[model samples]
Target chain A: MHLSFSSVIEILGIMAFTVSGAFSAMQKRLDVFGVLILGFVTAIGGGTLRDVLIGNTPVSWLRDVNTPLIILGTTIVTIAFKSSVKNLKVTLLVFDALGLGLFTIIGIQKGMAANFNPGICIALGTITGCFGGVLRDMLLNHIPVLFHKELYAVPCIAGGICYILLRAVVEPQIAEGASVVVISAFRILAVRYNWRLPRV
Target chain B: MHLSFSSVIEILGIMAFTVSGAFSAMQKRLDVFGVLILGFVTAIGGGTLRDVLIGNTPVSWLRDVNTPLIILGTTIVTIAFKSSVKNLKVTLLVFDALGLGLFTIIGIQKGMAANFNPGICIALGTITGCFGGVLRDMLLNHIPVLFHKELYAVPCIAGGICYILLRAVVEPQIAEGASVVVISAFRILAVRYNWRLPRV
Candidate 1:
């Protein structure tokens, strides 16, 4: 497939997640192979789940070798800057938010392309944006952080829905751009302002 | 599927894994929900992956309500005996070994039933036996114990090969029984004797 600007951003976002995932594993003092596994999952886990659920063959990472390089580069960068990142957790948060929104829109777009129902498309987009982290945590034996009343999944879903609604009113390209911005903006505002859903 | 003796043993093995997984979560000071997730992954994760790779819809736990119950029961028992088991790592090893062996054989059987190639079947069995632990550690942002150049994947392959070879010589029913026994026995003995592959 020909690469677009948005696709480049999306791939870069995957790289960022893979780096963080690798860093997370390193925080646990995992070995090199273990770090690679964490990186691999974080990079492709959500998208793989989305594709599998949609019955798409040859998972996304398998389709493109560049995906692994992105993951590898991210992992290397993460390890190199580990100590520096300790004081920059807030920066990390912002970056993660951007990736989250970007990935969510891309996920929804992928789902729509696959011709799934609106509900499932929204769900897949959310899964694609968020479930990679969930899978990473689940693999690490922690209850997924998302289920703990966080604003994570919400923004992804909101972005996906925004994309669908935006598409109904706007051109496809415009809708995609708007959806990414909406989700990313929501994440940024939520973090800065301490927005959260009501907990039972 | 009708419950056979093999099925009964498989459930028992899963119960053991669930107990230990929940116990590990408890040691980490996880809440009730977290413990359940750990137990669920420890017990059913291997088989669940096997089912998914084989294109089994809804996965095994979704197909079998009793599976969750067994995990729940095991979790309750594990939590009840948390203090005792916390100090008894060796006992946990025993159960983990047993579960590991049983899960491997079951995974290989399922793969064969799906008519996957033998090489893929063995790979699937090892993956089924071990990926859960890899996932567990990844979630915790830690290194997976399995990828530490240990006897982990090797033993699973060994056991799976045993099943395939034994089937060539024995009747179907006896072969199934023998396969499970051989795998479990090797697992137990390996742990007891500290048997492991040589370092490169």
Candidate 2:
């Protein structure tokens, strides 16, 4: 199958998110089935939610068999390498940030394609970037970290605004790449500095 | 606005689920905004999921503004009557059972309209019947009661199978109504007798 540049980025995001989810479930001491479910949900949950909310049906993951296969493969590999990979928290954070950035842009593009307003598009992008982790946390019976901590969704929202602005002056492809970089960089920096939102 | 007989049952289901959600959130001491969100999710979450899964765009709730308004109204009334309603656990369970039955039938009908096979339709019906409560429990940081205690989804699945069988011998309308009654009665009886599934 021929792979477009965007499809390649989406695949990378899926793999990264699956790894993040597998590690998280393992950390929680979930069984093999639980780990697999978490991996699949973390890889596709955000995109599924976005499609569902926007009336895009059969959802992206269900339409393409490759997505599930990729997640399954990732989960198995992660499990096999679990002991060696247990010490790489920083690496996990990096993968999570990359997935967050790529998914945010993908969500924005889908929203724009559907002619949603700019504000709504940004919200969709944020939801796409963050909801997978949200679902993972929820399933583990924890209040989602998104609701309380870190600079999680803010970068996606900011990057979405940046993408909209960049579209007026640059090529769409360039804007998309730039937005991904912006979000990923911001997320990494936020983690490095222990940035957090204050309580209401 | 004229209500068909089916629509009337649908409205009752919506109201029952909303009240169930509102009470659950209130018991947890969530703020008013949280209460409203829980109520809304409980009322429409299952149907929204079913619509999205079947490629039905602009989901039923979004197409009808009255649904959200009704949930909002129900939440407010529930909060206002909280003192008097606190002792009505049995009433709440009855409402929940009614909602489970009605939603199961509605989901089965939609799946049949889409020409899905019997098993997939039965699965869809169970999702519609139980996912709202599942979501509510998840958001509250609880392992979904559906996953553990009570004969929750069994009644929906059994009722769905019965609906399919009844279609062979009974009028379609009668089959629909009969399925709802079967599910509700089964659920109420299960709770009264403290029926439960064995641990895996």
Candidate 3:
């Protein structure tokens, strides 16, 4: 089965999130089963939420066998190279940004497909981009990254708006690609510059 | 509209969970909006999850406007009587147990309605009974009660098993009522006896 561009991005996002989750589990010294569970949840938690909210049942991961396989594979890789991977901060950051961007677009697209209102679509997009980390942090008994000073969900919301606006003037694929690029660049720049939302 | 017996139980569960969430938010010194958000999430989070898994769309809260109204009312009441309510530990415990039992049965019924496997049904029941508190604790940056030494999910799972078994021997309504009673009594007893799952 040939994969589409969106599917490719989705798989990449899954792998990135899985690796991130596995690393967190390792840092916490969770059991092997805990590591695997965290990886699986991080990779698909946001999408599962989006799908469920839109009334899509069983979720995409349950329908696509490859989703779990990829997450499992990523978890295995992370477990094997746990110590070495900890040193690859820049690479992991890049991958996380990529996943965030891709998931934001994917969530917005799904919401659009379901004919949700624009506000709902934007919210869905933000949830998709940021919620995996929320679930990961929650499971690890920490505050969610999004609820803090992070400029995380802001970029996702910006990208969602860009997608909505660009789709009218540009081709569908172009709009998607542009939105992903915008989100990724904004996220990476925000982190590099230490940009943060003001403390409430 | 005249309410059914089950609907009354569901509303009670919602109110109990909402008050629990509001109290947590208050303890954490969250703002009014934060308190309301937490209250709403705690009341409907588990049921929303179960509904989404079963392909039920828009979730129950969205369909029934009363759900949010009830949560809001509960939150207001909690905020107004916060100090006094703190002294009512036994009353709160009873309400929580009632909510847990009702939610467990509701989740199992939903899973059965969706034609899920028995294992899945039981899991759904457990999730429904316990996950609201999980979400509440997570949002409050504490470890989920279910993940720790608390004898929380055990009663839910036991109730689910009882529900399944009793359904085979009695009428569906009778089975449900019996399961709810068993769950509430077991939970209250466990708490009173300071029963706990051994720490890992």
Please rank every candidate by lDDT, starting with the best: 2, 3, 1
Q: Over 4 Å off in model 3, which ranges?
A: A1-40, A43-55, A60-134, A141-200, B1-3
Candidate 2, overall lDDT?
0.84
Q: For model 1, what is the alpha-carbon lDDT of residue A3? A: 93
Per-model TM-score (chain A alone): 0.90, 0.94, 0.95
Q: In terms of DockQ, which candidate is strongest?
A: 3
Residue B11 local lDDT, model 2:
75
- What does the lDDT read for residue A25 in candidate 3? 69
- Please list the C-alpha lDDT of all candidates, in the order they appear: 0.74, 0.84, 0.83
Candidate 3, residues A105-178, lDDT tens digits: the string is 88898989988898899899988888888888889887777798678999999999999999989999999999
Tens-digit lDDT string for candidate 1 (A107-195): 78788898889888899889988888887776666777777745788888888888888899999989988888788888878778877
For every candidate, what is the interface RMSD in angstroms?
6.3, 5.2, 4.7
lDDT of 1 by residue, B4-107 (tens): 77676677678777876776677788999899898888777777766664567678789789889888877887788777757867666665776677778767
What ordering of candidates by TM-score runs from best to worst? 3, 2, 1
- Residue-level lDDT of model 3, residues B109-140, one tens digit each, is 88788666666677688878887877888788
DockQ values of all predictions: 0.11, 0.18, 0.19
